[model samples]
Target: MTKSTIKVAALSAAIVTALAGCNSDSGSNNVTERPTIAECKTYEPTQPVIVKGDNQDLNFQTITIGATGDMHGRIFAYDYALDDVDVNAGFTKISTLLHEERAQNDNFLMIDLGDTFQGNSAELFNPLPIHPVVETMNHMEYDVWVPGNHEFDFDRDFLFRNLEGFNGAVISSNIIWHENAVDCKNTGQETPFLRGYQIFDYNGAKVAVIGLTPSHVSSWNASNPDNFRNLDFKEEFESLENTVDEVIAQYQPDVVIGALHHGRSETHGVVGVNEIASKMADKFDVIFMGHEHARFIEQIDLGAAFENGMDDITVSGDKANQVEDKAKSGTYNWRNRDSKVKVIEPGNWGWALAKAEIDLFKDQDGNWKIYDTTLSNRTVADVEEDAALQSEMQHVHDKSVEVANEVIGKIVGNFTNTSNGGADEAVLEEQVLNSEGQRLYTTIHSAKVSDMPLTDLINQIQIMYVEEKGSEAIKEQIKVDVSAAALFSDASNLFNGDTYRRKDSANLYMYDNQLVAVNITGENLKAYMEWSYRYFNTYQYGDITVSFDPEVASFNYDIFDGDIEYVVDLSQEAGNRIEITSISGSDFDKTATYVLAINDYRFGSTMLVEGWVTEEDKIWDSSNETIYAIRDMLTEYVGLNDLYRTEFENVNWYIKQYGPSDAKGNVADEDKGEILQLREDGGEGQDLWERLQNKEICVMRSGPGARDSINVSVNVDNNNTWFVNPNASNPYEGCTYSNQPK
Candidate 1:
């Protein structure tokens, strides 16, 4: 059958079943009868209600009313990480607010627009499953509840279980049951589910409340299909339109209110609510919106008649007020008269509460009319805590606190109980000293070097370089080269007095091992220097001069070659190899590869360093072990004569002659004295010893040349990695695995 035919057939079947059930009840005389007028008390409005005399001779006087808004509950379960204490406290607060409202508003009938369960820890562990939240709502005495999208989070069975004990009405106009009445009966008390909308009476006046949830729930629930299987949430406007018509015809009510669990219109715009409101403008009087957490108030009018293909005019603001005044003329004429509708929304998180009061009045003809509607929103503040409520909520709060405390301890150790700076330093020191320290075994992903006194080292290096150049001309050249390296490489040089820190392997404290700077021929050196200048040009630096032969060929990389290569000779032989005088390759590359100087994390291959792929590269352990090695070497070199101590004093002079320059072509001023002092003290230097014991030192040794060209290998077997390959079209080209291993 076609889809339309199937739908018609299903609808026909539903109508037949309903009619049959009604007939059976009528035949058995089982339906409850209504009371006669003589047995009921005369209806009277307990509050003032102003009315405008019009059709039906409706009297103008006091009328009973009900108002409710901002019933935000269980929304927390959807998207929050809270401990048990906070969750339970939240529920308790909701309960307290409900009770407070119940006591204050005599004619008030409480209703929730859904989203009560599923957000947080409380829902995760609620005993008796999905029903605990329902039980709490029951205790709060909800008059009616419309199921929201989250209501289906646990499946229909779980929903039914929790809703079983609820005394209030469960209403939804859009939900359609798959089974018949007979099937429902056969399924027993734990039947899969029930479907239909319900009507309730308030103060002798019949009021119909319809419920509709978002249609998107079908796809959103795909992750947990079993929970929402066999259920469908049709388009809300369509369902509401049909349901409102049927409801008005079956049980004429003075007011029609639609409770929906969809988001409000401020964000989605007036489309969704507008469509429902405009279509049912003549049908339903009010629409209660939920879902999106916002606040707004708007009106929709639908009584305008169509003329020639154009919509009828809608009167608003002063025009509407004038219309009401004109209606008081007692002409029973609706000509030039207009009606107004209001839409309101309140923000979420229990931060505010919305209050709306609708006053109904009877005209001279006894027909009911809306006198005046007042809306007021109040901020929740300085309210006294209900003692009894607090006691109940505290139980949940306490448990949550316990869980939070445990988790905090797990991540923070004893740091939580101590002072900040002092505690941080102490913990760091102890961790370095003890093998059980988290940092010792844990990988060091990055490092930050402080920028204070280090700039002085650059200045001294530059000055010393200029002095060594002899002639003023060569001195100028040396100054430029020294300035270039210092300016480009010195992250701290810019913005005078600014402190800098870097989280990388190339730092002074991390360089406890010996370093040997290889010398190149003047011609090749100029080329290398030019390349260095080019690389440094991309970075910023402080006052520093730098110059190089712009035309020379630096490294044997074809990628950087351009027209500039012809400006300088390329035949100059340059020594570009690093030789470790303190430790030979054999010393480190033993059968099992003995321990060598390197940072603790790199030794463990934490940052995924190249050449340290095998476990054997974890030779020297962390900086602590390397420091001990330095101490041992220094002690042996010093002997009883302390001859090495004198050599330490001259270390500064040696660095002044060969080290990278400062702005003045000398070794950095700040580091000059320290280098000498460290040399003199040897292993006995307090700073050196402290750094060693704290494992704050890093030791690294360089290799001959860029053999692999790649720094990091994506495929260990294929030897494919990233490197600054000058031969490639893209000099900084990254290599990928290509089946062959180099």
Candidate 2:
């Protein structure tokens, strides 16, 4: 039999053995599981009802809002191995926590902020009809949920299909869909599709929950905008303000809640937590924010209820601050307004729970008003896995393992891609030891250089895939000018001689970034390189150490491959790092247009590749109509090549030259001033090139670090992580680089 057939037979046999370990007694016989594909297909949409037992009572004074977001397919809890942090992230543990909270509090409501679907490497590649993750949510019993930007990671229909399996109230004020929202609005009945908002009767409290999705969902899947072009992510802040006013005038609820799939930030307005928080505090009593999977806890006091030139009467509450200590006592008639609210944003995954509890009292007039409140947004870590929940998910987990291990191809040899923050200990000890025999990583006086095969491999994969998407004439007209990728991990080492499994290919490339090819001019390409190299710090005349800004996310440290060679003069400022010397060993013409292959995320994400791409110039998008995820493409490439080998990689195209050489390496006095002048000018002359080639001034390579580049920072914590263009209003800053008509 051929290799592909033989491999499938082996995988099938292995799946039987792996699946045998699952809890057959529980998984196979659970009548409570969701319906079959046929039943789901023919089913009509219905609102998920609140399940009540004989002991369950609807009357309660305290109302708790349970929140979750960015589940990202983490159905089971696993060890994360962070040193200072405990990780208990998954739906199983979250299920137990949610269950316990319901019994303790009389009124408990749960909500999932967008990103409810997608993610989880195992089941994602070939998902079952009824997603097991959503089925698990059905068991946990959620009250409401809205789609996140990633919800569109698959086809638009796929999201609607998954929503079918979910047993929760669907509420999102900003998601404007073409098919479902109009019917739901006209009928005014609770349906499974879409709605502007939903009102809940929490005992005697009439609480309105407003759902909002990320506004940038449009650019998020730019490569595959065809699937979601019919829908639009409305301008949220203003839309939310209008919705709150309308909900008050119509429903006249005692309490209003803002639950969204948006992240919290220190900055105000647009993409800021404090900015949106100020607007929310005007009408909503409680808010749950998500998107960025980080820990946060804050009690934003937007002055007093009507203290900041506002009226409580707009929200059906008494106006003006009429009590001492409005925050603590809650005695003002405006207390019932959106004043003195609490916001929680439990971290992503099943890692933790975002929780809020509000105490509402019926005044002498019998109108519900807030008495007191408490809020907490943190992770629930180091907890025991819920055994029953674990059993329910056991079969799916086993199947994931079977699928993850399916061999796709074989590798020629083992390769190195150690992500030791570019500081190789062995390289340090042998090559970068101090004059006193100390490892340079710990010393401020050493420098090191490491090969970046991981980044190289990713670039190669993207380029190969981008080339295949078009014909020879099209490619010849717009050659892959350059391809971009990053060494996202420090320890992605691939084994040689072993068969490459589907999971191994995933490890080689994590994240579901699809391929995008766009046309960029030579001038814009230089600017793009300058933007990428901003992660590296400038060099000075000291006991130099090669260190990176931890604030700069590792994903931003992208390397490029093409028919060009450029030098990164680290001594320059953030916007002036690259010195493009040649295009195919000749002067680069500023007007030459070339095709640039990049992952869809970078091209569309606010934090990375947003500044350069022109929307109209998009040539070929791998996800235009279908999600040809880069990882899946890589797997295909490996299988087609028969042997996944890197020996064929040219390992050329670009180089990193330190700025010290431009200053004074082994240069004579006559050329010292000239070298410095050309370095600052970024000239393309041959004499300047000869001076840059010498390693005595600065190390140059297509790798991580070469000697000890200076003493680098070893302390990298999660809090220090930062993104590019975080403060821009339009993630792309309206900077569309190309112009191609639809």
Candidate 3:
């Protein structure tokens, strides 16, 4: 082919490529071939994007995106010791880095993905005044912000109030406020309270940033019925696709990016960064994801992503096989490279900043086209703290510490997250044991009775509250058992001291799990314990540790109390692994039915394993929607007793099978085995996961006066409204609202 002939063929291919990318279509192979309109114009491009570039032209412009999310109100620096070297992070450090980045690049956009206005001791109060985090972001001049899942952790009214308080534009494409939802100052209508997307005309590029919140919002906010009841969240993938198609037709942006509060993984039907890249990555240029509180820069190839069921493939032929871009780094597509979807997530708590650098050039037709890119995160520890920012936020910090220190109660002993002294660290160190044997001796499973403090305190408060608040008949006839998720279950602890402050309360509970009571047969109770124990991988002999499945959050694993003693047989499969050793200090009774005190989460949560609490099992409900209702109740209980020392109690229940057993199902290990009574095995845990893991824990009940002092709502959310079939292993119910009065 002559140079002139080759130029013509190349020009034709470039025009088709630019047009295909802008309109989100698969371009044709042969320049002479006239592809069907359906193939190239199913969704009209923003139009006017120049399609005249040859294969060797320089990009028109370069744009840099500096984004952060999951701030969690860390307006001030937090302390930690690294190799005995103290390090800290706060908005002050973030501001310094951000300023430096913006100064270096003129074409820059600053964004916050979400999870602000909550996380600190102050957020638990929902101050009548504005939060410092919002003000600091405003001062920093953020260009855009997307509300994350934690933003809904506040009261029903605080949801939009905080979002509106942001200094920059806020958008969410999938959230539609319910008609009777709590009234906030909502004037926007396309998707009530949330604008879909914003288009920026910058440096000759029409870049569009569309916002998206996770689709499982309802699941996470179920405990806060007042807030969740009025919000309609559509599936992420569908909502994102429709929004992208609409934005393309309306704005014809040179590049499109997604600002989503979702994360990298494919969580059910939610369309997160991974989902977008695999199915719609070629459609949108870049995505900033939040929610998992992790940090990483990765790419997704649509053609390759489809192998994992990420269907739609728009980029085709040679373009699909193009070499991976410089800006796109890491192997996250389960280690495949077949398409182009770039995603960024900065760590939470102002720990790092994700800077995504990309270059773009318009085709001869004047449309912007992104060609290459690179990304990296700057840790706050590496950057100098901004003095001015620190000074500005100092007052906020002082005020929080003041409010947190207000004494609320007294404690006798420190509640720590450490496991039972791990086989005497000194003794274990003297002997070089095998890895498996070390695990067997040091690891303390959640089932051990000694590991029961955190759960015991919360459950005690729950049972006591139900006793005092239930109807006189209920108080007289019903014996209550408490089910707590162990607030400080992992490595968190509540310090023991002469006096406890509000900060202790804040530390004690991290979720808005309201108090709830329900009825369960002793048989289902066994099933519940079985389900809880299923989380732990079977204890292996000669192992230093027992690990649980992370996919199944520890928060979902409830620790039951109130005179019931059960032995967990991890060797058995789920649904039948619980062995009821004793009940109320007597032989286990399969026929006994008991009134159970629980958080609204576990009572109505869809994350409950196999066959547990059916919607019909829920009976009593709390009027107040306090996130830390258990803590508040505990404070009241302590006040009633007028304690001056620690009030947390040791649970009476004991685990029968703690370590590995023999070939006959009996615990044979010389270590803490079956009946590894308290003090022998690791004592009660220091903490739980701190907050609800399964956003699906949103199953909530009666609002305000829906019930009186009895804590039982004759008129309430139906207890029988879960799982359409109620018998299915994995439940999927769309309509969760059940307002019919009992």
The candidate scoring highest on lDDT is 2
> What lDDT score belongs to each candidate, Candidate 1 first?
0.34, 0.56, 0.53
lDDT of candidate 3 over 92-121, digit per residue (tens): 778898789878876778888888766664
Would you give me the overall lDDT of model 3?
0.53
Q: What ranges in model 1 sit over 4 Å off?
A: 1-101, 178-196, 265-271, 303-338, 408-742
Q: By the TM-score metric, which is better: model 1 or model 2?
A: 2
Residue 712, candidate 1: C-alpha displacement in angstroms: 42
Q: In candidate 1, what are the lDDT values of residues 1-742, reduced to their tens digit?
A: 1111112124334434433322111111121332221101211111111121223332433222222233323322111232212221234444455556657655455566676665333332333332435544555556666777667755456665555445465666665433333333344332212233456544445557677776655544433445555555566677777777877788776666777667533112223665666556666655666665433344555643312111212122321111122222222112211343444443343333344455666656665656555443333322333455444334333433332222110111111111221112112221121111001211111101111122223222323322332223323322111111121111111112222211111221221221111112224333333333231111111101111221211211111110011121111222221111222222211123211122222222111222223443211121122212111222222222222111111111111112333322234545443323343344544443343224343211011011111122111112122122222432111111121133
After TM-score superposition, what is the CA distance of residue 266 in candidate 1 from its true location, in Å?
Answer: 11
Total clashes for model 3: 49
Q: Report the Cα lDDT for residue 401, model 1.
A: 34
Instruction: Give one digit per residue, the lDDT tens place, for model 2 in 439-552.
Output: 222222111122234455677777776776643325554458678776653434455577777776666566777888888888788887777777666554321224555335
Q: Model 2, residue 120: displacement in angstroms? A: 1.9
User: What's model 3's TM-score?
Assistant: 0.69
Lowest-sum lDDT 10-residue window in model 3: 685-694
| Candidate achieving the largest TM-score | 2
Candidate with better lDDT, 1 vs 3: 3
Clashes of 1: 56
Q: In angstroms, how far off is 225's CA in candidate 2? A: 2.1
